[model samples]
Target chain A: MTMFTVLEGVAAPLLRENVDTDTVIRIERLVSLEKVDLGHWAFETLRYRKDGSDNPDFVLNQPRYRGARILLAGRNFGCGSSREGAVHAILGMGIRCVIAPSFGDIFFSNCFQNGVLPIVLPQAEIDKLAEEARESAAGGAFAVDLEAQEIRTPGQRTVSFATDPNRRRALLQGLDPIATTLQRDGDIESFQQRDRQARPWIYG
Target chain B: MPGQSLFDKIWDAHVIADLGSGTSLLHIDRHIMHDLGGGRGLRRLSELGHKLRNPELIFATPDHAISTEPGRTSETTPLSSGYMKVLREETKKHGVRLFELGEDGQGIVHVVGPEMGISLPGVTLVCGDSHTCTHGAVGAMAWGIGSSELVHVLATQTMVQAKPKRMRVSFSGRMHDWVRSKDLILYLIGRLGAAAGSGSAVEYAGPAIRALSMEARLSLCNLSIEMGARFGMIAPDDTTFEYLAGRPFAPEGRMWDRAVSHWRTLPSDPDAVFDREESIEVDAIAPQITWGTSPQDVIAVDGIIPDPASAANPSRRHEMELAQRYMGIEPGRPIAGTPVDRVFIGSCTNSRIEDLRDAAAVARGRQVAKNVTAWVVPGSYIVKCQGEAEGLDAVFRAAGFEWREPGCSQCVAANGDVVPPGQRCVSTSNRNFAGRQGPGSRTHLASPAMAAAAAVAGAITDIRQLA
Candidate 1:
């Protein structure tokens, strides 16, 4: 587990709504790929044309957005599939944080597990950040301090956020959750013993 | 406490530790995995020097990455075979139970879990696939988890989870014969967009849900994940108990009685208050089909393509326009007569024997329309054998449909089984996301019967009208 403190980098705006995992990292690219920089295959259909050149129409393909470490995306980002490959692709692209109005429950959780911070902000705030990102693609950097629960815009504007305190602590300390669960092995043992006796059917 | 919703009851019971603010460490009763996603978790566990805490609670099978071709072996498909090889080797090394191809228990994780009675009431089940919600129909707290958590659960038979808000969707009216559970869910998603159930665990109740068989309830809960809900469930009832009675892994005799006694107490109390409540009138739900990329981009079989100008807002209008261009369907054209080039009638969502019977009923005496390729992959080897014994496979074969073996076939298109680029396919799988089946392929999600009807008609047609 990698500890997260703050990420300060260029924020690219991917404003399309309902950006499903299939679009995030198409299932085709995810099937037999090696453990490499999957960012090359992220958003395969949208980022590349049939001839294999960059689809100039895609936001990520724009030269100004290169090396972006923060993503300002639309609602329901990572909406389909329980694929962590989507996160692998997002991180592969060097994106360390994502700001969205909302996200699919599983995708949001996966981001945290993979050391990427998923920040839920109001749509108005995201729209504002998206605007700032486009304006500052060359010289501006968006900074997010997970410890302070705040996102710093390119214009040095501060916006606050909220997260479950323990998850936040875990992220800050880079603690594996299973290790955290292991600290309570006695309780888990008690649960297993009681659960088995109480409901023996599921055991079969 | 006495009036708690089933969601609350399950969540409260499973919490091993409350890591404040709504997060809790949940004791996982069952953790299932498959070929495509399970191998990485095993590698991570080995790397971390963590022996599986409870190998007995873990089940593995090769479904997502196995070929559904008859007589297919690992060598037949290299990409899928590689994943299956990893699954076979890892499960063997770990002493985890695995159902490989040609085995009786071999099937899609969801189908095999419930069919083997491993997914029972009052348990918390997690799987590496989103359609794992299908097992929630048997009154369990079941949902999908990603690869990262799969490793966590493998290392420690528990995972930390955040409590989601509770939602109850009541379908108060009686469904018509042609309106299967698939139609009801499509109608729900169509009426409410794909994100309607986001961040909530939905419980399906009311007369319509209760009237459904265990298979139908599974179909409904399966798509609940499609709408962005991590999980969905129906309270266990006599229907569930009866369905699990004689299954291979189900308990027998007095144990069955004790299981029933516990299951009957798992329903939500009458006075329970849901965080959110929704109602759907099912009497008027006709056979439905998707016209565009999203499952929510659907219409009744008789309806026409939606005009973007009629959209309520610019964002929605933009969505309509995108779906229109991608699907190559013009506005105002009736969806019924839209020609289809392919038909796929199998997926975790609708590949059970009952689902096969639905398609078989439609394809019994009809030949698949010329130039339209169609296939029928059973949900499991058990289902395939049963279908053959009951002549359901013959009905499909007689209709010019290729009767294939069991696995997650073209549903995910992992095994080189894909709809060609620019081809129109009516499929029974859940998601209609762009490029979900294949790049540049247009998929119109439908019920098994509806997909079968489309195969014969060479176009989308209401199943009721076909009869």
Candidate 2:
């Protein structure tokens, strides 16, 4: 995973509610394409026409929003499926941050694993940020400073955010979480020993 | 100490250690995986030089990407063949059991887990698919995990998770004649918005829930994820125990007695307090169906399509309008009598034997509409055999509905069986998302009986009317 700290770039406004994992990347694409190449197929149904041409109406396909690193979305974004490919697709598409009112529980967790910052903001704040992104589409760069725990819009507005301190530390240092958890093997082993004696049938 | 919820009891039992900030390292009692993520995660774990910590706790099957065609092999779906092959190889290499296709226990992971008695009361189960919550019906503390998390669970037999608040959704009153467990859940999601259950573990309780059969309970809990709840469960009762009794992986003799005693203590305490509570009256719930993209975009089969202008907010109105356009539905129009081109009667949600019996009852002595193509893909190979032994397959075949093999067919559209582009399908699947069945495919989620009615009528019809 790449270390996430200060990221500044254009933010695409995909403010539709319930933007599920299926929309982020279809299951067909996930099966056929490599993880790194998933960017091309991210939002394939919404981004491209049936004939494989870019759908001009999509926000991400617009010239100004191209290469966006931030995504301003609506409530419950990434709301369906536990497919981690959704985060891979978003990261592949160069989106390092997703700001929404809320998110699906599994998708929110998946984002941290892949170094994609899923920030939860009040809907009012998200609307403001989305408006600013739309108004200055040509050069509306949003800066997401994970270290500072704040987002700065092109309009010079700074909005603070909160994330789990442990998750924040992992993302900042790009540390593999499994390694950290494995260090507590002694604790895990002891617990298992007790549980096994208590419920032998559960232990296979 | 006050009282503990069912979730609280199960969660506390599984905590290996608390990592602060409400997160805990949870010992996974059961970890089920499917072809799509299982193979990739295993290969990744190997690349990282990690060995499986507890292969005995892990179960793998190739359901998501395997073909459901009759007499199919791993190569039946060329695109997914490599995934199936890799899953077979990885599971073999790691000593994890793989439920091979066409075998007795093979099915969708969620369906297979509970049927094989791997998902038990008071146990914590995790799978790489969102519908893993389906196993919670057996009174397990089950939820979905992502790819990286899969590798973590495989390497350590545990996972780091934040504790979710407890929520109790009690369904009171008897259901109407034509209504089913699918309708109860669909109605709940429609009444409460899609995100209502976010950040909580929901326990379905009350007389109506208790009255449901084990299969119906499974169908109801299957949609917990659709309502944004990662975990949904019911207290283990006679219905759950009877369902698990004599199953392949269940405990035997003295072990069974001990297991039952433990499960009896797994329900919420009498004085248990939840962070939130909700009550629903199910007597008036009709057969529910989605008319738009999201599962929450649903209405009664006899209800009219909602007008976007009446939406609660601007963004909501925009979403409704877009959904209407994509679904090719007109605002304020009655959803019933809307023509459908296909009917799919299978998925982890409703592919159990009871579900097939329900659909077969509707299809008996009837013919599928001329222009409609209907298929019944059983949940598991055992379910297929049972359905055949019960003569449900003959009813479906006589009614022009194709009887297919078991897999997650047409549900995710990765297995080559899909409703074509721009075609409308009345499906007994969990999701009705855009392009869920196929690109440009419009899905109306319904009960199996309702889907069968649609197949016969070639349109969305009230199941009550048919009855």
Candidate 3:
């Protein structure tokens, strides 16, 4: 859990919308995965062919954004399945954060849980950033400052975004949700005690 | 005080600690596990020196990576056997109840949960699989969680979650015989798009949902994940209680009476208002099928493949283009009679007994197409036994469809139950995502009967046109 402050790097343009968990990382990759290098298989079907050679046509396969640390995506990114492998693959590939018009609820929470920032902005702003990212692929990088709640384009334009203060704190402090849940162990114990008397059969 | 919707009441009851900012420590009544990522969580918990706080509250099964091939054991494949071993060893060491493959109660986690009454009214259930919402059919507030979240629940029997905004989707309809609950959900996804239900807790209400059998209700809630919502529910009523009565995990004696009394109060208050509302007035709905990669790219049985150029929204147009290219379908072509090479009549979405009966009806006395391969994989051993007792297995076998054991089968290609590359299939599974069935395997998501019809026709054919 590395503290996420300012992440500056090439932003891969996954312009397509509804980049589902299936597309983000195949179930096959997760099933046989060990040590979690699933990032290489992100969009495996689209990124590679049967011969195991890179497809070269996919945005991630192109050399310019090959190791991008950020992603500029379409609306409704990560829409299906609550597979955390989607976020794992993204961060595993060194993509520190994702900027989309919106994201699937579970995937959004997963990104925060894993300390990979998922920023939601309006389509107009996202479109601008995607364009800026493409133009800067040769040299400059797209920069995100969580503390400032802004994304600075390579062209020097700062686009502000909003994130929950609590999520922001977790990202800044690199705290996972499990760690957060453990903080209320006493309350959880109290609820269990009260519930046991109230509804005994719900327990095994 | 504001009147609460049925979802709000159920959600509020589960809150152990109000974490503020819309988040809370919610108690989990049940934690169902499947083989895909099942024991991985327990392994992590053990490594951290944390034992399962409540093993009795958790249940495990090997469905995702198990073989549905007839006479199959864990040794059907290296992948399936390895996954089965992982859960068997962990659940044994941790004392969690497991329905191992080839065992009596073994089945898909979603199916086994409801059939055994482990998922009941006024409960909070979580599973590592996305389709866990299928349990919400019994009026539970259920959703899918990731492995990390699964570990958290294993240690605490609770999860930290943000309360989702409540939405009521009222469906009132006069359904034609060919129209099933599957069509209703596919139609909704087509109209709403995949992202429409993304963050909402959707409650299906009104006449249409009320008329659905418990299995049909489960079928409807099962695809809530496909439309982008993790949570979907139906208010528990007489239908729910009746379905659960006397089942293995349901309450008995005086405790059953008390539970029923509490469940009756779970329905939304008469004055309750949801944060949002959606209504569908369906005089008649044709059997629906997806023609493209996304579940939302659906059309009526008689409709044509959509043209991306005709889309009004640019984003939708882009999506349409990609889907069409990936699915290998041409725009404006008729969807009906589109040739298929395989027919899959099973999955959490439509593998229940009620679903099997419909497919068997279509298959009665009809031979599968000469060039097509078809399979009927039941949802669970219980469902398989029940279907066999009713002789539904004969109906499928006589019609030339393979009668297989219950597991995920081709619904997910995890254990190698896959449609080959460049092949097309008519399946009852939830998703039709590219490479979902297998790389270059194009899938058309349909109802069981529709799949049966397709199996016989060797093409996508309407169930109404059969017999």
TM-score of each: 0.98, 0.98, 0.98
Residues B1-467, candidate 2, lDDT per residue (tens digit)?
77999999999998998888999999999999898899889999999999889998888888888888888888886766888878888888989899887787798888889889899888999999999899999999999999999999989989999999899999999888879999999999998989988898999999999999999999999999999999999999999999999888888899999989989999999999999999999987989999999999989998999999998888889999999999999988899999999999999999999999999999999999999999999999889999999999999999999998888999999889888999999999999999999888999999999999999999999988998
lDDT of 3 by residue, B313-378 (tens): 887798888888877789988898788899999999999999999999889989999999999999
In candidate 2, which residue ranges exceed 4 Å CA deviation? A33-36
Model 1 chain A worst lDDT window (10 residues): A28-37
**True-contact fraction for model 1?**
0.70
**Between candidates 2 and 3, the TM-score winner:** 2
Model 3 alpha-carbon drift over 4 Å, by segment: A33-36, A137-139
Query: lDDT, candidate 3, residue A13?
Result: 79
Best by DockQ: 2
Instruction: Quantify how close model 3 is to the true structure by its C-alpha RMSD in Å.
Output: 1.5
Clashing pairs in 1: none
lDDT of each: 0.88, 0.92, 0.87
**Pairwise TM-score winner, candidates 1 and 3:** 1
